[model samples]
Target: MFDELRKALKDWYKVHHRDLPWRHTNHPYAIWLSEIILQQTRVDQGLPYYNRFIERFPSINDLANASEQEVLNLWQGLGYYSRGRNLHATAKCIVDNYQGKFPSTYKELIQLKGIGPYTAAAIASFAYNLPHAVVDGNVYRVLSRYFGIELAINSSEGERLFKTLAQDLLDEAQPALHNQAIMEFGALQCKPVSPNCSLCPVVATCVALREDKIAQLPHKVKKIKTKQRFFVYHLVRNAKNQLAFTKRKPKDIWEGLFEFPLLEFKSEAEQITFLKDKVQVGAAYKHILTHQKITAYFIIDNFPAAADTEVIYLDLADLEYHPIPRLIDKFLNAHRHQIFSVGQ
Candidate 1:
């Protein structure tokens, strides 16, 4: 079964695998950066970031030596900032303990900060051609559907089941190519929505296709209810053309990144007038996250030069020095007129 899957997958991958930037290199540092950036990010969206990271760091030592703020700044628009933090921590570990060399074995790799089982497997196989299973979202989806498994992907049982299956299916002869081929097959062909079954090379042997249960085969745990959040952003600018921004602390969304002064309300029924007393109101917008819809109200305020002592000030000319969330970036763009108008 593994041999049949491998042959079909290898044939398909020869012509269909994406020419990703990370795929062009075997350097563990580069592979690690790509994997970190690609977490919770689409391949197309993650590519430029991957290039930027490689250009910025160039090596594990470079990344390890850089400040956390600098690392977060580079990872600004890419959400899930913990990945960046973990990447930085792992780089430091590699440089300090491993003498700037990424660990070759999956055991040593997993011991490094931020290198989880899947990431370790990816690095092990992709970098060292080590025989290890890479059980990512794509692989889970493909395997669950192909095997007609109904386990909820979020469950521990599902994790063990798929990990076993992935290992069983791995081709020891060319672990790197085989692992990449299966992952790529799932990403491009056995997609979550509207899969291109007609062009799928493995369709002939796909159990889901034979049973006519493509969509229903890979059962998922029901989504948890998302709580709504109301955020009032005080986009205060003073006479010096400086804007107010605050760095979010760790454990918060957009951690280590700057945004306008935020006042979070439990519900939308909170009075805007009450909010106005806290910060001068100027503009407002709503932004949604995977688990929350944040109704963000932007407030612009002008203050006397002496009164600007409280807010963190970014010189209008040097706003780029600070790393801000994309939502804040959008708000600044939308209210540029209001900010510029005040100083004029």
Candidate 2:
């Protein structure tokens, strides 16, 4: 059954696989960039980032020499800022220790920053044709449904089972082609929602298809409750046409980014009195992520030229230099008139 499924997948992939840029190159640096950029990001969204990264850092040495801020700037709109930091750190390690060459072995790749088992396997197979199984979200979904596996993907048992199965089914003769075929089949055919089973090459052999339970086969444990957060941003402007912004530290989300001074509130109604005492409210916006919802309040303050201030101030002209969050970008667009208005 495994051999039949593999042959079907490979045949279909030969005619229908996507012509992604990374597929054309066997360079480890390019493959690593694609893998990192594609993490938690769609191919359409990640493509531009991948192109930009390759254009900027054509070589591992180039990435190693680049500053953290520059790398973060290129990765600004892409969330998961830690991935960029990790990529930079890993590049530096490669340059310093490996003489600007990516480690060829899967074990050595895993030891590098941000290169986990999945990433290391992907690089090894795709770049070097090494015998390593690449198991990612798409692979898990595809395999679980195809085999009617009941293990929770988040469980330790599930991880072990899938890894063993993936390794067992991998085509040792053509590791790169086999890895790409499985991943591409998963992404394009055995999708998370409304998979095109009718057109799938291996649908006849799929256990979930035979049982008419595609969606329910790959079960996961109950999801954790997402936390709610509130942010009050003081958009204070002084006589010199300067705005208030501060850099987020390394530990927080959007690290190394800049934003208006923020005061977090536990709830919406609780912040009214706090804002009333500090500054006048201008606008409010809500930004949602996978695990957090941020209710942001935008406050504007115009003070006398002589009023002493304690907030970090930056000239409006320098706003481009700072890394503001998308929520703050929306707020700025909504209140552009007041910010650009002629008044001390």
Error of 1 at 196 (Å): 1.3
Give per-residue CA lDDT, model 2, range 1-344, as digits (tens).
Answer: 98998898799899989999999999999999999999899999999999999999899999999999999999999999999999999999999999987899998999988889999999999999999999998889889999999899888899899999999999999989999999999899888899999888887788999988887968788877888888877667766767877777676678877888777778877876667755444656778988888888776654223233245789755778777888877777767677656343
lDDT tens digits by residue: candidate 1, 119-223: 999999999999998998889888988877888888898878889989999999999999899899889888888899998777778888899888785788887
Best candidate per TM-score, number?
2
Q: Report backbone clashes per prediction.
A: 0, 0
> Clashing residue pairs in candidate 2, if any?
none
Off by over 4 Å in 1: 223-344
What TM-score against the true fold does each predicted structure earn? 0.64, 0.65
Q: Provide the lDDT at 222 for model 1.
A: 86
Worst 10-residue lDDT window for candidate 1 reads 301-310
* Predictions in order: lDDT: 0.82, 0.85
